[model samples]
Target: MTRQELRHKLQQVRRNLPAEQQLAAAFQVADKLEQRLESFVPQETTVAVYKSFAGELPTSPIIERLWQLGFKTVLPVLHPFAKGHLLFLSYTSKTPMTINKYGIEEPELNAQNVMPLSEVQVLLMPLVGFDHQGNRLGMGGGYYDRTLAQWHNGNRPNLSPIGLSYNEQQVESIPVESWDIPLPEIITPAKHWRF
Candidate 1:
């Protein structure tokens, strides 16, 4: 199947999951996150993450876990000036929110809350599908592809880009494009895959 077709299929599967399964997956991924990342990331370091939407793996638990562990959490905000790019904004329970064009909730733009990519130690990305080889299939907007291209090109050597997925999103193989950046790690309800 084509990438677009696969995206639709996986998305539908996730959307159709029972509420109990979704809650279970949320906590499971958070547990794996704390087990795998807590040792490597220092307290107060900025970690970039996203607001889960469209039946994606829930991230509220993960974000709360980071807070409980004393790690700084940031969420992606649509870059007001950069057409298709994204900017990271410091996210907290009190952070103001706004719905973007795509109807996804994001942290309201605030200059003081913006976190630079260089300062981010880990980026927890949302993906539609992935393979054993770590190839990720995003929502086809290329938002993350553009962001990770800098890291792939060696601009941000210390950045650890990790994908958060569900077991149902796994596929046999994904045809890669020139700009596609395979993740170094991905955490799911079932396993923590490293490449």
Candidate 2:
């Protein structure tokens, strides 16, 4: 199936899941996140992750776990002036939030809370679909693709972007565009995939 076709199908599958199942999956994902990430990241490392929406894998539990483990966590905010880009902002349970154009909850823009991509150790990228090779299919706007274009081009290799996917979202292959950046790793509820 085409990327769009796959997106429609997988999105339906996720939305159809019972509320209890979604909760269970989120817990499993959070547990797995702690196990996989704690071994590699340093104490001062900061993580960039998105706020889950539209039946995407839940991220709140993982965010809480990261905080408990003493890792700084940030959420993406649509750049106020830069079109088609994102800026990572410090996110905490107490951080003030507002709905963006996409209707996704994001931290209210604050200059003092901004964290540059170069300083971020890992980005827990959200995707509609992914392949074992780490190819990702996003919501078609290419916000992340554009934001990480420099990193994809090897300009600043320090920024690492990895996907957070559920087991059912995996496809055999993801039709990728020339500018698409394939993930180096992806973490799911059941297992972690490294490309």
Candidate 3:
């Protein structure tokens, strides 16, 4: 299937999941991540994650657990002047919130709170779909594509981009673009896929 067609299909399945199942899956995902994340990231390392939207795997529980476990967390903000790019900002329970133009929730942008992607150890990203090869199908705006281009090109060695999705989002193949950025690891409620 084409990229857009596959995205719509997988997203529909995600939205159709029962609320109870969604909650259960979210919890299970948080547990699995918590168990594995510490082995790679050290104490107080900053993890960049997104605020879940639509039928994307819920990340609120995971964010709370991150704080409880003493890991600093960050969220992506739409870059004001840089179109099709993202900026990572410090995120906390008390961080001021705002809705971006795309209607995604993000911590309000503040220059002082902005973090260079180099400093973030792990980035937990949301996706429409992913494949076993770590190819990610995103929402198609290319925000992450532009932001991660450097890392994908072998510039950011310290940066680890991880996709967070539901098991249902996994597919046999994902249409990839030259500019597409593939993830190194992805975690679902069922298990982790390392590429």
Instruction: Quantify how close model 2 is to the true structure by its C-alpha RMSD in Å.
Output: 1.4
Candidate number of the best TM-score: 1
Clashing pairs in 2: none
- Could you give me the TM-score of model 1 versus the true structure? 0.97
Q: Which ten contiguous residues of candidate 3 have the minimum total lDDT?
A: 35-44
Error of 2 at 33 (Å): 1.5
Candidate 2 lDDT (Cα, whole model)?
0.85
Please give the CA lDDT of all the candidate structures.
Answer: 0.91, 0.85, 0.87
Could you give candidate 1's per-residue lDDT for residues 44-128 as a string of tens digits? 4788989899999998888888888888888998899998899999998999999999989999888999999999989999999
**Candidate 3 structure, TM-score to reference:** 0.95
Model 3 alpha-carbon miss at residue 91, Å: 0.8
- In the range 1-195, model 2's lDDT, one tens digit per residue, is 777888888899888878788778888988877777766554778989888999988888878888888888889999999998999999888999999999999999999999988889888888888888889988888899987787878876887777888888888898888988888888888888889
Each candidate's root-mean-square deviation in Å? 1.0, 1.4, 1.3
All candidates: TM-score: 0.97, 0.94, 0.95
lDDT of 1: 0.91
Candidate 2 is scored at a TM of: 0.94
